[model samples]
Target: MRKIKLKSISIAIVLIALMLGSCSDEILVEEPRGVFTPDFFTTELGVQGGLTYLYQSTRSIYGFAYFLNLGETGTDEYAAAQSADNNFHDLDLAGQGNLSSTSGFSIGRVWGTSFPAINTASGIIENAEAVNLDNSLIAEAKFFRAFYYFLLVQTYGGVPLDLGGGELKFNNSVVRTSVRNTVPEVYTKAIFPDLEDAVNDLPDNPRLTGTVTKNVARLFLAKAYLTYGWWLENPNSIPTYPEASRTDPDGNSPSYYFQGAYDVAMDGINNPGPYRLLDCFYDVHVATNDRHEEMLFYSDRTEESQIYNEADLGWSGTDGGGPNTAVWMVTPNYTTITVDGVSAVQREAAQSYGRPWTRMAPTINVFTETFAEKDLDSRYDATFVSSYRGNWDKGGDTTPTITAANGMEIAPGDAVISFLDDYDPSVNYVNGGNLGGGEIAGRSDYVINLNEINRRFYPGLWKLGTYRTDNAGGLGSPNGALTRPFPIAKFSELYLVAAEAAVKGASGSMSARDLVNVIRARAGKWCYDNGENEPRVEDNSAAMVAATPAVVDIDFILAERSREYFGEGYRWYDLVRTQKWTEYASSYEIGGNSASDHSPTVTNRTIQPYHYLRPIPRSQIDDMDMSQAEKDAYQNPGYQ
Candidate 1:
C-alpha cells in the first residue's frame, strides 16, 4: 500500500493583481493575484482559495485506504485479510499481545495535514474582518479548523495547540517547549468555541454537498460534546490533567455534554432541512443518487472537486490519491472455477466492485446476525454480489465469446455462489447436508445466506460494487470508473445519534427501540413475502436474529449500526466511546475465506484501557526534543 507523506507547509507568496481599464466605461477592474500573501486575503478570491484548500486537505482523511486503516478495521464490525507481513495486517489482534501503536507514517499524515489546515483556517479567521466577503466563508473556515482539531484531539489527547497561521519556532529551551492543554481546554478553547460560532455563522443550506452548513456544524458539535462527556467517565484516561467534570464550567453533572449532544441531534432531526433518509436504502450509495436526502456531507470525488488526482497514474508532482469510493470494504481475491457447466472467470474488482486489495472483510458478527434475514431485510441482497459474468476472455475486446465449455450464459444477476461447504474443520468429515436441500446441498443462497461463498470467494459487499453500471456495456464498459464518492455523514446516522442521545438522557420523543425499529422495519420493507423469510427445511438457523423484534437498547442500537453502517468506517470510534470493546466483539481468520489454506484463525484480541487513545507519532515526540520528565508530561498517557 502507498503511504501519504506529511511535510510541513509554509504559507506561500502574495497574489499580485494587475489593474486594467475597460475600453467602454474606463471602469477599474481588480485582477486576481497569482501568489497568496497576507494582503491578498483582503481580496475576495484569496479568502475563497484558502477556504477551498481547507476542505481539500480533508480528502486524505476520508480516502478509502486511510479510513479503513484508521477508522474501520480491527473493530467488532470488520477485520483485515490475513496477508501475513506486518503488525498492521491483523488489526483485531496485537503484534504480540498489545494492540498496535500508531505508525509514524500514519501519525505524521495526521499531524502534518490537519495542523496545516488548522493554520490556514486560523489565517482565514484572523483576517475575516479584513476580507470583503460574507462572514459565512470565515465561518466555514472555523468549522474546518474545529473539525481538524477535534479529529486530532480525539486520537491523541490534548495535542500541542497552534491556531494561527505563520511560523512557530522551537528551540531546546525548556520553557519554550509547548505544554499540551488539558482535554477540556482543547475542547472549550478550540473545538467548542470555533464550532459554536460556526453554527451561528454558517447558512442552513450549503451551496454544495461537500461544503459545511449550519446543520453540519451542529452535528459535529453534538458529537464533540458526546465524546467529552464520555471521556469524563473513563477511568483509564486523563493522565495528569485535573479532572474536568469536577470543575466544568457548565456546572452540571459529568454527563452534561451527553444532554448537549442529544439536544443538538434533535434540532438536526426536527429541522426542516433537506437532509432525510432516502426511502430506498440501496439508493444511498449509487453514483446517480449522490444527491439524495441522506447525504449530510460527503467527501467530494467528482471530476470537478477531485483535488488529489487518481488519474495521475505516475503519482508525480503532488502527493497523489485519486477521488475514491469505499470499495475496499468487502472484496476478496477469488479465482475462477467452472460450476454447473458455467465458466465465470473472476473479474478484476476495479471492473466489477472496483479494485479490492482485499483490504478488509465483514466478520460473522455482521453476516449471520447483524445483516441476517434474506426475505425480510432487503439490505442483505442489495449489498452483496453473489454472481459475476464469465466473459471467458479478458483481451481488452468489447465482447468476449462464451461456449458450452464456458457453460450456460449466466446473467449479470445470476447466482455467483452455490456451495455451502462450511468446512468447520471440526464438523466436516466429507458428507454434505448444510445446504437448503434443493439449491445444491449446503449451497450458499446468494440472496439469503452466504453458503455458496467459500474461503477464497467471500461474498463481496454489493454496496461498494459499481455492478449496476456493468449492465450497459458489460465488464469492459467505458463508464463507472472505480473512483467515486465516499459518504461521511448520512442523515440515517443522525437518527441513530438521536436514539443514542435519548438513551443517554437526551430528549427522546420516541423510545430507543421505537427509533431503532424504524431502521429495522425499513430494512425489511422492500423484500417481497417469500418462503425464505424464515429458515428453509434443511437450513437449521440462518435467520434467527433476522426476525424483526421490537426489543431495543444500547446493545441493540450498536448491533443495528453494525448491520447498517458496516464498513462505512464508524466501528472503532463506536467501540472506543461506548467502552464496549470487550463486550461481544469476536476474533476471526482473515486473508482468505473459511476454505482457504492460507487463512489462519486468530483469537484473544486485546482491547485495553490504555488503547482508549492512540499514542502521538514517534516523529513528533522526537521533534519536540522533550526530556524524560517533559516527555511523560507531554505525550499521551499510556504510550511509551
Candidate 2:
C-alpha cells in the first residue's frame, strides 16, 4: 500500500472552487499545494471540502479500465479479447500469464486509494464532532469509510484498520508498519458499526445529487450482511487469508445475517425516499436519463465542466486517475466494418459507437443460454449494440449510395452489419469475407448468426458506451473517456437481495419467487426498441412473470444478476460471494480471435481454491516496514 499522508489544504480549496465553478459556464484551473495543520478540518469549509474529495476519490477505481479488468476479466461474463495485453491475460487464468503478487493486475488501486480516503474520512469524522457539524455531514464521512473498507475486505481478504495512530484514527504522520485485521474483526468493528450509524444519521434524501442517503446506507448494509452470510456459510470450503475462522464475532449464525439482509432490503423497498425502479429497463441505462431515480449512488462525471470532470471532455490518451474509459475494453472495432467495400460504421461520440480497444469479449453462453429469452426480455436489447448503421458521411466518405450484401443500394444511416438475434440456418455464410460469419439472402446488411459471433465481431456494450453533447454535425471525439456517470448502486438490486436472502431460509413476508417476479415484471416493459431503432410500446409482464420458476435457487438469482448487471463490474464479487466462480466459469465457448476464425473454441480456466482472494499487491508488501518472512506471510497463500 502507498503511504497515506495528510492531504494539503490546497486540495480542498481547488475542489471547492471546482464545485462552485460547475454552476457557471466558466472552467477554473488551479494548482493544489499546502501542508495540513491540526486546525484545518475543524472549520466547516475544511469538513465540506474533505467530503467532496472523498466523493471524487471513487473515480480512481470505478470508471478506471485497470480496475474494471480486475473485476470482470476473470469471471464468466468476459474473457481476454483478441488485442488483450498481459494486464488482461494475467487474470484470465488461461495460461497466458500468471496472477502473482508481482503481476500488473490493478487490484492495488483498491488497496492504495482506499486507505488514503479512509484516513481522510477519519479526519473529517474526528474533527467534525469537535466543531459541532451536523450529524448528516458526519454520516457522509462514516458512509465513505465503511464503503472503502467493504471494498477492501472483499478484494484483499483483510486489511489494516489502524494506519499509524490507532484503529480508525486520523494519522497525519506517515506509517509503514501495519497489521492485517481478521475479516470478522474488520466487519464487526468497522464496516457494520459505521454503516449502521450512517443509516441512522443520514438524511432521507441527499443534500447533493449522487451523495450518500439513508437508502444508500441501507442498501450497502444489507449487501454487507448478505456477503457476510455467504462467508460464514463457507459452502465451498474456500480458504480465507490470515487463517481466520469463519465465525461472526457477534455470535450470530449465518442465518442471522441472511435474515438481517432480507429485513434491511425490505425496509429500503417499503420506504423508498426519492428512489424507485424506472418504468422501463431501457430507461435505466439511457445516457440522457442517467441521473434518474433508479440510481442510488454513482461516480459522477460530466462533459459540461472539464474542471469538475477532472479530465478533458474532448480527448484523453491516458486511462489514469479520472478517465471513465472502462467501456473501451468491451467495445468491438465497429469502425472497421464496411458495406459495399466502403467503410460503413464510422466511430462517433454517441452512446451506440465508441473507441474500441477489444480487450474483453462476452462468452457465447451469454447469448445462447443466459439471455436466451432475448425477444421477451428488453434487457438484452438495451445492453448490447446488435446493429451497426452506415455513418460514412460523418467520416467524410461521400459515397451517396452503394450496392450492399444483397446487391441492394444503401444510403447513409442504413444498416451495415446486423447480428441475428438467433441462429438462422438459411443465412449464407462466407468463411473469410468481411470480418467473420455470413449474410442473409435478401438483407441489405451483412449478418452474423448468434453462434457465429467472434472476438473480433461481437455486440458492443451500448449501456456503458461513450456519450458526448458537443458532437456537432460530424464525428466527434469517440476516443475520449466516457463522460457518463458510472453507476455503483441501483434501487432495483434491493429486490434481488431480498429474494436471495429469502432463498437462503430467511423468513419474510414476500416469498423468493414473489420478490424475483417484481424484477421480471419490470424487465417485460419496453418503451424503446434498441435494435429496431424506434419507439416501442409493449408489455410482456404476464409472459415474463409466468416464466419464473416456482422455486428460486442461488443459481437462478446469479443468472438474473448477470442478465440485469452484466459488464458493470459486478461479476467477480457476485461469483466469489456465492463461491460459484469455479463451477460457473470453468469453461466458456467463443470463436478464435482472428477475423476469419468463426469456429467456436472451448477455453478452460484453471481456477483454484486460493484464487478466491486476489494476491496481496506486491507494492503493499514491499512498502510495509517488516522483515522478508513477515512479508511472505502477509501475502495470500498461493501467491507467496
Candidate 3:
C-alpha cells in the first residue's frame, strides 16, 4: 500500500520542470516566465507533473464508473431532481421490450477521455526510456495506458488499436485505424504485455508511500483479465455482421472476444498477486483512507495526511460527502438504518451541509425485498446502513449540518420507515412526508402510497433516510439538514466477484458450493423457531426472521448478492453479467413503491444477446463519415 506524498511530489514536479526548461532560449526569450517545450519537460521532475495529471484523471467523477450508476437498467437517478421528464421515463427498471439505446450517458465520454489518457501514457512510455527513467515509474504509466484501452474495448467492442503512440506526423490524416482488433487480440497485444512489463519493472512497493504500486498494477491486471474472461465467455449472440461481405477480414465476432476475456481473468488471478479479499467486512474499515487488502487498486484521495476530500460517499452528505438526494428520497420508509450504533435518527441534522448528489437511486424491484429476512446477513446491514443497532452511528455521533452544493440549508428527517417493531407495515406511511410544505418541504412532493401501510415512499429519503433538524429548511440554504452517512465500497463485492467467476468457470458442470457458503457464513443470520419449536427449514416462514446456516447454491448466491450489495451499485452489473436482466426486476412481481404491489404482467425471462452489450451510442454513428448503410452495418448492423 503505497501512499502518495502530495506536497513533496508537487514541489518536485515544478522545480524539475523549471530546471529542465531553464536552458531553452525559446522559453526564456518568448516569455521569460511561462514554461514550454519538450526540453523543459523531459526530466524526472517534468514527468512528475505529467504523472500527477494522469493520477488526477483516474479520480474524475464523470467517467464510465459514475455514469454506469445512472445508465444501468435499474434505478432512475435522473428523475429525482424532476429533471427526467422527457428522455428517461422508461429507464426506471428493465422490463420486457423496455430496453432503449438513448440512455448511454457516459459512452461518448469514455471514448474521448480514454484516448487522452492513452496518448499521455504513450508519451511517458516512449520518452521516459530516453531519459533513463526509473523502471518503476515507466511501468506505472504503461499500466495506465493499458487500463484506458481495456475500458475502451470492453464498452465499444473492437476498437482502433492506437499503438503508434503520440508521434503522429504533421501531414498525418486522422483516419480510423482499419485494423479494429478483436477483443482477444487487444488483450494479448496491449493489455497483457503492458501488465507483464509493469509487474516486472514496478517495485513491489512504490517510492511514494500512498501512490499506485505493484499491487495496484496487479489488481488492474486482474480486473482486465476478469473482464476479458467475461467477454470471451459471453460473446455477442447474433453476429454484428453475418454476410461474408459484412464481416471484417479477421472474422472475429462478439462471442469469440468474450471467451478470450475469461481466459485473461484466469491468468491474472493465478499470478498470486498481493491483493486479497478481506475476511471481516465490517472490521476492515479504513475510513477516510485507503484499505490495503480490500481495495486492490484505487486512486488515492488523501492529500498531506488529509484524505483527498473528494466525495465518493454513496449517500448522505456529512463525513465529507457530496449531494446524493436520490437515495434519500426513494429508500422504503420502514427500512430503518443505524449510523455507527445510534439510531440514524439522531444524526439527521448534520447530513444537510454538503449533501451528496441525490443521483443513483435503487430500483424497488431490486432493493425492496432485500434484507426481508430478519436474520438477514450483517454484511447487508454494514453495506447499507450507517449503523445497525436500530440506528446509524460510526464512532461517536459526529453528525454535521446538511447543506446544498450551492450552500443552501436543508434538514434531515426521520427514517422513511421504522423497524422498531417486527417489520411494521405502518412505518412507511408514518415516514412519508408532505413534499409541498415547508421551505424544504416544497422542494419535494414526498409522494406516499397511502394504500399500503408498509410501503417505501416515491423519491425516497436521501442519505439513509435518517432525519436531521439542520435540513428542516430548503435545499442549499444555511438552514438545510445534516444527513451524511457512511458509503459502502469494499464490503461483500470481492466475495461476489469471486463467487460469480467460480460459478461461471464451472460451466454448469461443477457445483460452486464453497463460494456461496463463504458468503452465507458472512451473511451471519438465519431463521429460527420459537422456544417451543425446533429450527427446521420447513418450519420457517416469511415472518420468521433468523440467521441462515444453509448450504449455498447459485440461486441463493444471487439473492445474497442482492441483500448484501444493494445501494453500493452491484445489482445492475450482476444481472447483466448473468444474462438475467429480466429476472432482476421480474423475479419479484412488485413494482413502483409498494412491497405488496405488482406490475401488470410483462414478459421478463432470459436475456436477449443484444441486451448484453448496449447499442453503440447514436452519436457514434453520426460521428462516422461512411455511407448510411455502411455506417449502419458498422455500428448498428441489425438495423442495416
- Compare the candidates by lDDT and give the number of the best one: 2
Q: For residue 602, give model 2's deviation from the true position in Å.
A: 0.4
**Model 1 ranges with Cα > 4 A deviation:** 1-40, 96-107, 163-177, 235-247, 303-326, 335-343, 346-352, 389-413, 418-456, 466-481, 527-551, 586-602
Q: Please name the candidate that would achieve the greatest TM-score relative to the true structure.
A: 2
Q: Which stretches of candidate 3 lie over 4 Å from their true place?
A: 1-42, 61-71, 75-104, 163-179, 235-280, 283-293, 300-360, 365-370, 373-376, 385-498, 505-512, 515-565, 569-571, 582-608, 617-630, 636-640
- Model 1, span 412-531: residue lDDT tens: 333343322232322221211111112333333221124322334455665555432234344442223344556677777666776776677666576665566666656654422112
Q: Candidate 3 at 352: error in angstroms?
A: 9.7
lDDT of 2: 0.83
User: What lDDT score goes with residue 335 in model 1?
Assistant: 38
User: What is candidate 1's CA lDDT for residue 482?
Assistant: 42
Question: What tens digits encode model 3's per-residue C-alpha lDDT throughout 1-640?
Answer: 1111111112111111122231212211111122223453366655655555555455432222334343343421112222232123334433322434444343354554555555556656667866777777778788877877776665555554542322210111233222245556666767878987886787654454334555556545655655655544443333322222223235555344333333333343444344454544433331322345445444433212112324332232322222223233233332232222233332232222122333333333333355444343444333343211111222234454333212232233423222121222322221222211111232221122222222222223222333333233322222132122223233234444455555544222223454455455544532322111134223222222233334445456677766554444445455554545554454322224333332312323334444444455565555454566655655533321
Candidate 2 per-residue lDDT, tens place, 1-640, comes to 3233232111222243122222213322322424344467788766766777788788878888776688889788898888888888989998898898877747577876788788878888999877788898889899999999999899989877877668888777756667788899889999999999999999888776677899999999999999999999999999998889998887899999999999999999998999999999999999989988999999988887777676787777555677888889898887777656787788899888998888998889899988889888899999999888778898898889877776778788877777889888887766312666466767777778767677877898999888888888788988778889998999999999999999999988898899999999999999998888899999999999999999999999999999999899999999999999999998988988876666788999999999999887786778767789977888889895
| Displacement of the residue 578 alpha carbon in candidate 3, Å | 3.5
Each model's lDDT comes to 0.54, 0.83, 0.40
Count of clashing residue pairs in every prediction:
24, 1, 115
The TM-scores, one per candidate, come to 0.78, 0.95, 0.61
